[model samples]
Target: MTEFILPSNANDLNFRHRLPDKRLAPWVQCLWSMGRPGHLTESRTEKFYPDAGASLSIKLTSPHPIITLCFNKTTLIETLDTTAPCLGIRFKAAGTHCLLGLLPEAFTDTHYRLDNELEPLGLQGLIPVVERLYQSDSQQGLRLLETWLLHRLESQPPANSRITKIVQAIGALQLPPQQLGATLGFTRRTLERKLKREVGVTPGQLVAYARLNRARHGLLATTLPLTEIALQCGYYDQAHFTHAFQSLAYETPAAYRKRKLSQIYKA
Candidate 1:
């Protein structure tokens, strides 16, 4: 997932992310942190792009920590107000189901406190660990979290190879949605049902996410023109790209590019 931080407030915020260790790479996407660079004085709003995954967020607060599970099918805009830093673990597309045994569809488009949710799975023990994680520095906390996730992975049954392969293919945008069933030796209907049950999205939706992810990076990371980025990302033209981007992101490509670029200039 990409975090869009406007330049005006960038200096006041401390945001960092890093990939997980190789052992946890298949399930964990990345670990992230957000907080004030100095004393926390005000709130900050951030925009998060859709990445077809779920995240576990831990906010360091008074008395006790605040923990939540966030899973969204579209862009998420949120404001943060905390004295201490917030930590998060972003799970891969099917990772929440593979590791936590939670149905992705149930948590779609919303966030919930994990206290009650984890109790049912006998994972309430994780609450304390999460609190400790918030207290630890980024390196120590990420290592501790990875160790726990590695242990959990050892106990859980292996993820379905076919589903994993399908997700990889879709994420890479190598397989067309229509050909997914044929390539995997399942009927289209069966494929759709299984994917939705496990991945929380249809194959087509996954493709859209993959394309958007690429286009988003292009707009933010490079100086490419919209027409060039649209064609490179497999859209027919700039208009198609703009419509698709706006439908999922609530902002047109040109607007998004301009806003992000303006931030860079001001920075």
Candidate 2:
């Protein structure tokens, strides 16, 4: 699981990640809790880049709601005005459709209010649990949600093995799409359709996301120069890397690094 915590740098914000229960492990990636104190003097904004899958979240704030969010195709910028407690269930690459009963393509680059989508499917039982989440502690809320998922999974189909394989190959090998398609015994066209349906993005977009994801990790963990980081992440040059990074991250790599470091020092 991926956990993001900047306690020392930004005490107002905290995020926790937990492993999925064994029964739901094949379809779920992780369970997460994130939020900030409502009394903060200044607001915050977070930028989320494209990833491999989607999530169902309970947002505890004004216009309180539960929603299903598809993996982003471009950058997603979220502005926080008050205390925002969020609990999320991240789905595996090919898992959301079985639970949500919607094609992954239908969700790309957007979020659907859960009640509006799930009510038609007789999932109204979820509303009470969501209300309890807003009234109880985070752990209790998470446990309730987990239980609901377990019940939901009892009748859901298994994840698509081929889509999982393709995602695994993309993360591990970073091969060109055509070569990856060939390896999977698929033509490029066939592969694109499958990826769009299962992963919410086309092959080329996934590759770019993979490259940027690696660069993001390197930026946070290493002292390497920007040019070196660019090459290591498979970009042709620093200039090209800067363009892509800024497009997705909303800041140049150097600026992002500096801001992070400044936060640590100030803390």
CA displacement after TM-score superposition, residue 183 of candidate 1 (Å): 2.3
Candidate 2 residue pairs that clash = none
Q: List per-candidate RMSD values in Å.
A: 2.7, 3.3
Q: Which ranges of candidate 2 are over 4 A from the true structure? A: 1-10, 22-27, 35-42, 61-70, 81-84, 121-125
Question: What shift in Å separates residue 22 of candidate 1 from its native position after superposition?
Answer: 1.2
Worst window of 10 by summed lDDT in candidate 2 = 1-10
Model 1 error, position 247 (Å):
0.8
TM-score against truth, every candidate: 0.89, 0.82
- What lDDT would each prediction earn against the true structure? 0.76, 0.71
Candidate 2 lDDT over 99-157, as tens digits, reads 55557776534766665756775567677788888776667777888888887777665
How many backbone clashes can be found in candidate 1?
Answer: 0
lDDT of 2: 0.71
